[model samples]
Target chain A: MRVPILSLGEVLVASIQDALTDRGWRQLQADLLAQAGRRPPPGSRRKTAPRGVVIDLSTMDVMDSYATRSLDGIARMLALRGAETVVVGIQPGVAFAMAQLGLGLASAGTAVDLEAGLALLAEQVRGDGRHHGA
Target chain B: MAVTMAPESRLPVRDDGEIVGARRAARALAATLGFSETDLTMIATAVSEIARNMVEYGGGGEMTFAVIDGDGRVPGRRGLRITATDHGPGIPDVERAMQDGYTTGRGLGLGLPGARRLMDEFRVESAVGVGTTVSMTKWVV
Candidate 1:
């Protein structure tokens, strides 16, 4: 399925609602990267390129190594484009499975949900020396 | 008394979709046996990894989910058994394949090792150019 990347103010949110095929994941990466790189033209509601990306995985019951690594790559690439990524809504069961499998998103910041994701983004850009350097 | 009505399912893991089907089947079957939600997710995730590898490396394969009793060694112990078999270019170095971060340059190389860690028992039998079979089981806790 084509995972939609919704722009929430300065944050782009993609809620994974189903099993993403290999192509689906690749497509999401491309779309998110493209969107993350693009800035709203002048005269838009607020300015600056998107500051953060939120990927929701509540509906994803299975996060195999493939998915975990893909998400990590997305976070790193987005950082390169000056956008931070926050993964949110990982199910408890899925989290346990990931821990057992020794799979993890090493670089991406994680939040409990979308609201917290946005909050984390805001905090990172707050210029308070707590942004984790990106 | 043992539940003799142990059910089993075989799913053809050909494409990405079938890999999903296999995961669902595993979770559903495990649920019927009263596996906890965490266990269900673990089984499903392990199935996903092995099934994806079957398609990505083995060019397609089959997955079998069965509620099996322990074989002689631990009789009456019932749990879920997952076996994935593929007839493709088998691994030349099975040992290396089971190591974390040992990939053929496509993925993070954690599929096999991660799957193994999720399950209680895991065994991989492969012959270069012959075929590969992975059998893993998670006992009820």
Candidate 2:
């Protein structure tokens, strides 16, 4: 199973929204859709469903509730298409804050730092393929 | 410099499902106070939850935010103070309202309790037929 490496940098939800209006978010969704329709990477394993998505959240300067909820919506949308998502680099403090805010991503899948997240994804892909396999 | 504080600006809850606006307000306020991103998110989430509660259960209310400095004044670290007040029918039992997974409607009932959990200081006051006021403070430092 070939996995893509997603490196998340500092993302400030406040800054992102300020930089892009609602149109920007719409554009992002459109871009993702267009990209997903493209051909798979060379020598990629063919499975019942496409491999999952990896998100790097380590560089997030500030993540507000609105962004968290929006991200949640995005994750759920991707899940419907049988794509697993791995969110890495979420600060422990931020994770706690998200939990307190009721984001509940912890239950959705595995969350870890960059190294751990990748290792976990690799293990999941090697082990049961059914963890997120649709 | 005499800092002016008004709680009325933050009042007038709206449950139009405008989560963006709620978070926007929180980020803006936290930034002005030099709060961290984590703290900013927490404040915005609390505001969103409480505001939703006002619209859902209390039939809407007014919210107010105040700037609090920690020169050994109030308790905890320095931070901004947010208060939501509503004249709608108050909660019959405050304790039940604070409990997690407790809701009178389709909601997850994570409003009040969830908001309280995000902030360092939280207080709720309510009376039958009168209304309810929820005050929360998040440390900036």
DockQ per model, Cα: 0.77, 0.22
Quick one: best lDDT, which candidate?
Answer: 1
Which stretches of candidate 2 lie above 4 Å from their native place?
A1-48, A54-83, A89-93, A100-106, A111-123, A129-134, B1-8, B69-78, B139-141
C-alpha TM-score for every candidate: 0.91, 0.62
How well is each residue in B4-112 modelled by candidate 2, as lDDT tens digits? 4544345356554443455566668778888876777677767777876777788877777777655365453456788888888899999999998788864667788
Q: What is each predicted model's overall lDDT from 0 to 1? A: 0.87, 0.62
Fnat across every predicted model, in order? 0.87, 0.32
Pairs of colliding residues, candidate 2 = A8-A56, A9-A59, A10-A59, A10-A60, A11-A59, A11-A60, B10-B63, B11-B62, B11-B63, B12-B62
The root-mean-square deviation over C-alpha atoms between each candidate and the true structure, in angstroms, is 2.5, 7.3
Please write out the lDDT profile of model 1 over residues B29-108, one tens digit for every residue: 99987788898899999999999899889999998888886554666777899999999999999999999889885877
DockQ of 1: 0.77
TM-score of chain A of 2: 0.61
Worst 10 residues of 1 chain B by lDDT: B1-10
